[model samples]
Target: MSDSIRLDKWLWAARFFKTRTLATTAVELGRILQNGQRVKPAHGVKLDDMLQIEHAEQVWEVKVLRVLEVRGSATVAQTMYQETEESAEKRAKAAQDKKYYREPGASVAGRPTKRDRRQLDFTRN
Candidate 1:
């Protein structure tokens, strides 16, 4: 019920990460930042603080609204932080781009197996 909470716990409560451990790991790996500075998992998160978080290929810029000790439903968790308009737009654009233009190697299997290589050499000679 405190106005301030641990960074990891808040991230979990806010649904940024599915679990507190993952949030802690992200914080330790420098995937989470507070007001543009690297923060520890145990860092205190207060109201109005700006957070920059990276998950997968998306970056989020959010402002802390209220701290909660309990993790709640998606709708409730969304109230804990307000994402910036620019951040939302950027994420949407990235999603659209990724959907349209994916990595060329995503569906490709690189290199042939040893057996296939042997077959190719036999067929060649």
Candidate 2:
């Protein structure tokens, strides 16, 4: 019902995020933007403003249609904003792309473990 709302609260109320804390964390990590620039959790959001929110590997471009300071139900929250067509398309494509790379038991696979590193060092010396 407000003309402007806190960014984190808006994100939760608009259903962009599941919780206020998650929204704040996203903002802190530079994953939330307004008008193409990163924004803080406390940033004030106004109607018709554009928001770029990064979740996982996908980015969502949403337009603020209304502002509510308090969180609401899923159906009610959905009425607070609208997602751009391009953003929806991009999200769909990103999901489809991920389907190709998904493999069972393929955990990140980062750098070698400590034991492996030590063995490599000994062999080199």
Among all candidates shown, the one with the greatest TM-score: 1
Predicted structure 1, TM vs. truth: 0.85
Model 1 lDDT tens row, 19-59: 89999999999999999999899999999999999998899
Segments of candidate 1 deviating more than 4 angstroms:
108-125
RMSD to the hidden true structure, all candidates: 5.3, 5.6
**Model 2 spans > 4 angstroms off:** 103-105, 108-125
Model 1: how far residue 108 lies from native, Å: 4.4
Q: Number of the top candidate by lDDT?
A: 1
TM-score of 2: 0.78
